[model samples]
Target: MGALSVDELVGRDEWDSVVRQHRRPFVVYKFAATLDGRIAAEDGTSQWITSAESRAEVHLLRAGCDATVVGSGTQQADNPNLTVRGNDDPRLDLAIVHNPDRQPLRVVIDSNAKTPADANVCNDAAPTLVVVAEGADASHLNGVVDVLKVKRADRGLDLPAVLTGLHARGVRAVFLEGGPTLAGSFIAQGLVDRVVNYVAPALLGSGKSGLGDAGIRSMSGILRLELVDVARSGADVRLVARTVRSR
Candidate 1:
């Protein structure tokens, strides 16, 4: 309801307490896109969509998180390091979800193995965690990464199980830096606790929609948000909204 200053916008006290209020695993969805709601350029290029100040605020948000999550598509296409480079604090742990066994420690929902060893998330800075259906490669992926095999009825990881596993790891709060499909999954499951939008002024035509093909049709299905604060940094606008429903 009220406007926030630059310091209040990026400070730890504001988010840390709110995030810690969750006794179970809570997910924070952070995204930045064009005014048209496109997260990437026509060529799948999405580098620095928000202003430097907004991006810096993202890092601060990461610091308040226990872990950061993203889909494997983001890792393969964007090759993001996924590290928390804070301006005033430390970094958060990173997690990835992948199916078909393309990445290790990847939260996969399918029975098939498809992730590649050379994937960017298979690096040292942020180890991978594969969440796959039962009967996936149970062979020890120990030194490289950790694997979490779940019992999935359909071709997807059980959402509650995934959250339970994450909670076991002391990840009370999770930040989702997504490519659309993953975002859609979380939203559809009604698992998102907060949404942070760093709106940029630019417009890019025919690029990837934030969550491509994830049907979020009706307005009623949209997640309810309580406007916590709004701030402007240069040409960008930071809108921080917390989900009001409980899971």
Candidate 2:
């Protein structure tokens, strides 16, 4: 009827309605892609996929969240600052899944120390939380970022525990802007709360798809969504969908 609240569009109410309410943390996923589901061009270049206005909208989404996360692939590809800018109160804490000591609160999910020392996060003036699993190669990076080594029996970053710990640090909401692998990890874990897709009117058939083989076995395994709204942004289509779990 009236202009919807951000929460209404993202299904916060439905999420709260679930029997197992996610008290640990809430997640918001944001990504841009072409109409044919391509996230990057054939050469792995993706800049200005969404409009400046849509980028501002994403910053607005970041403004409302406590932490913004990205993966090492995205870190290497986009090298995003991973923080909100150009808003009334822009800025969100950053969380990168790489070696924190080698990088910045870069969280290394692997049990080995392979991150380089000159990663951008390490050079940036931002607080970081480097997460590492137990028995990881202890070869340290020369104090570029803070290090917090966590033990994971599964030999992978314990994402649920990571979220719980983040919530403990007052991160009520977390925004994930990772590439498809990390996004797929969250989706497979059923940890994604909602998704915002900015669809551009173009095609890149042989590049990376927005959601690669992250683990969706079939069409049924894809995360179901309820289209809440769609609006045109120049020649682009900004589609907002709420995950079924939230509904």
Considering every candidate listed, which one attains the maximal TM-score?
2
Model 2: runs farther than 4 Å from truth? 1-20, 87-117, 137-143, 151-156
Determine which window of 10 residues in candidate 1 has minimal summed lDDT: 95-104
Error of 2 at 204 (Å): 1.3
Tens-digit lDDT track for model 2 on 1-247? 2223345555565644432366666777788998888888888888878777677667557555556777657766765565445524223223322322222223333334444566655556455555556666545654665555665634246788777777666666677777787788777778787788889888777788887445678987767887878887556777877678654
- Which whole-number lDDT from 0 to 100 does residue 158 have in model 2? 70
| Candidate 1, lDDT over the whole model | 0.63
lDDT, candidates in the order shown:
0.63, 0.63
Model 1: per-residue Cα lDDT at residue 118:
56
Candidate 2 RMSD computed on C-alpha atoms after optimal superposition onto the true structure: 5.6
Cα displacement (Å) at residue 115, model 2: 4.5
Q: Lowest lDDT 10-mer window, candidate 2?
A: 96-105
